[model samples]
Target: MHRDTASQRLHGDLIGQPGSRDRLNTPALILDADAFARNVARMADFARRHGLILRPHAKSHKSADIARAQLASGAVGLCCAKLGEAEALAAEGIDGLHLTSPVVTPPGIARLAALARRIAALSIVADHPDVVDALAVAAQGGPPLTVFVDIDPGIHRTGVASPQEAVALARRIADHPSLRYGGVQFYCGAQQHIQDFAERRAAIVERTDYLSTCLAALTAADLAPAIVTGGGTGSHVIDAELGVLTELQVGSYIFMDREYSDCDLGDGGAKPFETALLVDAGVISANAPGLVTIDAGLKAFATDTGPPAILAGAGESARYRFMGDEHGAVIGPDLPGIGARITLGTPHCDPTVNLYDAYHVIRGDVLTAIWPVTARGRSA
Candidate 1:
């Protein structure tokens, strides 16, 4: 049972003691350190074997320590959902940050510009001329800001609608002195979670076809992207096969959620990554027959992807259902009584992680360390 003095100082008395996994406050985020390390190594190896740069999305874990581990394990850099996340990671000396989402507001642009000057290398995505112009104006007199033209892969969420628009934005970024055209970002966010492997592959093929058109347009204008970065955990293998993406911007692979677990690998196999993240909860009430309530529910995990799965404890027949904002019902034969502990797997790792303040790092049954979710609530 060893405790780091820095962790104690930062977390104060709230940090749990070593070998105190059972005593840890319930409904806390639990990270299986071994599985996490293996996942990092597996993805790194996958990227290396495929000759693709691995820039794991930090928005998944949001822990600077986890980002460090990914980088130490051969990740080229990190991708963040917002400027605040990039700033938080940069504060920890984590360089090579890419803001995946566009920053159009004045304050966000200013922050992005300031961060570009401070970090080793900072890049951001833009899909509109106004955003490109704003970034160019904000980056004036600072280090050259790398800009990725975001192309819509039919999601129509934030990217440019057409390849023509993507080309136009790329030309604008290239024309701007303060901006450097990094490449194109074509992420089909909706297609990332397609359950069937064949369907996922087919979807990516269609997306990549659109991407090829965008790439062709860029090339025809003498604005070939140096990098074509966009792919998630579900589509990394498909993306590699396409041979278009230079870097994989995957996030959830480090912490495979139940939703991701349900996604078919196209080969009729399980997901490539391990389930490294879990929620440790305690049975608070077992008053009912064959049913018990845990201390985790909608407030503890994200509900967008459905209820969290009961990974361990409460017997083999255990089933979990959200009862309310702070309670979950465990129904099954031989249910664990009050005071029993159970490990619940998240439905969606990204939003589920955002609900926690820190991660309780566990090695086997011992609580080894606690790392703050530094970028938690940094969705700007």
Candidate 2:
């Protein structure tokens, strides 16, 4: 893995180089600045129109610059996937940070307590009393840390299974010495892109109903949830209209990927966000007929959602297949010859982004800026 030194070291600057789009940069990540700005604005407007607080997830971009732009465009704050991510963003003075995942270790909890002293409001999620107890001990006399109960809502991920479990966890958080019960998180990650509108809606309805029940239980126990957070780019509209999610935590809306493009929001149109992020690679070899190879392969993108879509140059039916560690194979009728450049639309933006060191921000064919993936290796 290439350590991201673009933020510190000055290698060949890819952003301002001549023939940037045409030059073959091996396994480089690209971002369309215009498209990214548009996506951010659209999501911000959507939040404003529906009276919902937008706390975009930083786990997608992992760049302080992108987080700053979201904040400037009226985002309430940022949501990170881990305590390390929160620490990285807090180092950049990002206030109102929320750690979406449960963090239970002593060192992790200690870091969270230290961060709570500087930021406006720092929060995290938990699904059990053990984690809450650990966090309470860590924040014994430090600043009060706002803790949220994570509800599974059929995802069966890192959250409590039912309303009863959520209520029990909330009570534990409330009773803990250093933890304050902030609210509940009901993010159904699996149902984010179900492809079918009715299926997606049904999934969200079930999750929302579960969240409502949890909230009711919390209230009955005199522990009214102050913040109800969950939802992604695909379910933002539904979550907003349902009027249950106090704050929407959509991340990938700022850079729509091939996966989200396949999701029909029942609007008879493509996703309302722009395709901002792309992987720029060079055609390294033309070994066979109807086949061309590029320098971006499994190392350039995550294979969990399959290979990326081959955009730019030649045909609409160009297929991107993983070749090996650092190469991608494309097959199409009009696939260009050797040394040709291409922009691949990532299958999954978040994990694919984590594979890159820096993003080459571009305006049309002109390279403009470079932003480091600040929290790139922050997986703790």
Candidate 3:
């Protein structure tokens, strides 16, 4: 086992001491410690009140420290997008890790089996018979592998197409002695950001109805799943109300991004979770009037959703435009002079987080801690 003292020393060196946030380098990812704590508590309380299992997706933050905080806040487990991510968290002693995506390749299955032996409980998703067979063969002499049937809820990404397909896959998993059928993973990745509350609810209702059909088929075949896990930060409330989702895999709630902020929460109010994640960029040049250039550009934050929003400093009202790979332009009146710092909120948290090496954790303008992005490049 990894030593606790060694881990503390390494984190201590990475974080150093709590002091002014200005002392840190520019264009770094910063986490508001207070806001982060509040977000964790809020999500945990919501899950507890609704009687839903909270399995926050680690793909959003990818920091073991953040995962520990979520687990401490009453999360049942952590969900990862890839085997490398699961391996990184497992190395830090995070048990109950579940891979949200399916693994069908022989080499990936072999690595996952190896990780299963080390962790207390590891689960993965499957939408095809080939993946089921490969996983069963991989777990021949190892411990029983838990598997969830991936149900494509209108996303058509990677899951079984129909209820009949889901039942057949569940039966095949049960037939394998090395595999234990966990449940169904019905996630609508595209529906999460629907701007209208009624639209979001309609999308989830349609998906949940399909899920109920799969559940009934599974029960008829005497393969009733013990867990029905699928729901994101956007539709957790709706999923809980439908009475089908046993656990919620909401990840981005910990760090609200501009895309989530733009989404309606079924109510004309702000998101319950605070915007805890920010990118600190410094004014590199103020050569032009009413315009200042920052060091962060397309490379600093994810541009697929949109440009990053200025959260603090003189650039709050400024319009952010991508200047180049290494630079961004903030155009507005009374822009900050050269060397001044500004906080930028990412358009999307997950991919934006992948760009950073560590989080400069802060509490009231003082850098309190630094958590390494342990799973930053764990896409393999």
Q: CA lDDT of each candidate? A: 0.87, 0.84, 0.88
Q: TM per model?
A: 0.95, 0.94, 0.95
Tens-digit lDDT track for model 3 on 1-380? 32333323434454545566776667888899999999999989999999999999999998899999999999989999999999998898888999999988889999999999998899999999988999999998989999999988876889999889999999999999999999888887888999888899998899789889988998998888899988898898788788899999999988999988888864566678889999999999999988899999988999998898888877456888999999999999868889999888989999999997888788876777778888889998
Model 2 poorest ten-residue lDDT run: 1-10
Model 3, residue 171: distance off in Å is 0.5
Model 1 ranges off by over 4 Å: 1-19
Per-residue error for 107 in candidate 2, Å, reads: 2.4
TM-score of model 1 relative to the true fold? 0.95
In the range 189-273, model 2's lDDT, one tens digit per residue, is 8888898877898888987887888888889989888888989988987888789998999999888898888898644665688
Query: How well does candidate 2 score on lDDT at residue 50?
Result: 93
Model 1, position 72: C-alpha lDDT score: 96
lDDT of 3: 0.88
Q: Give the Å error, residue 241, model 2.
A: 1.5
Which pairs clash (backbone N, Cα, C closer than 3 Å) in model 1? Answer: 197-266
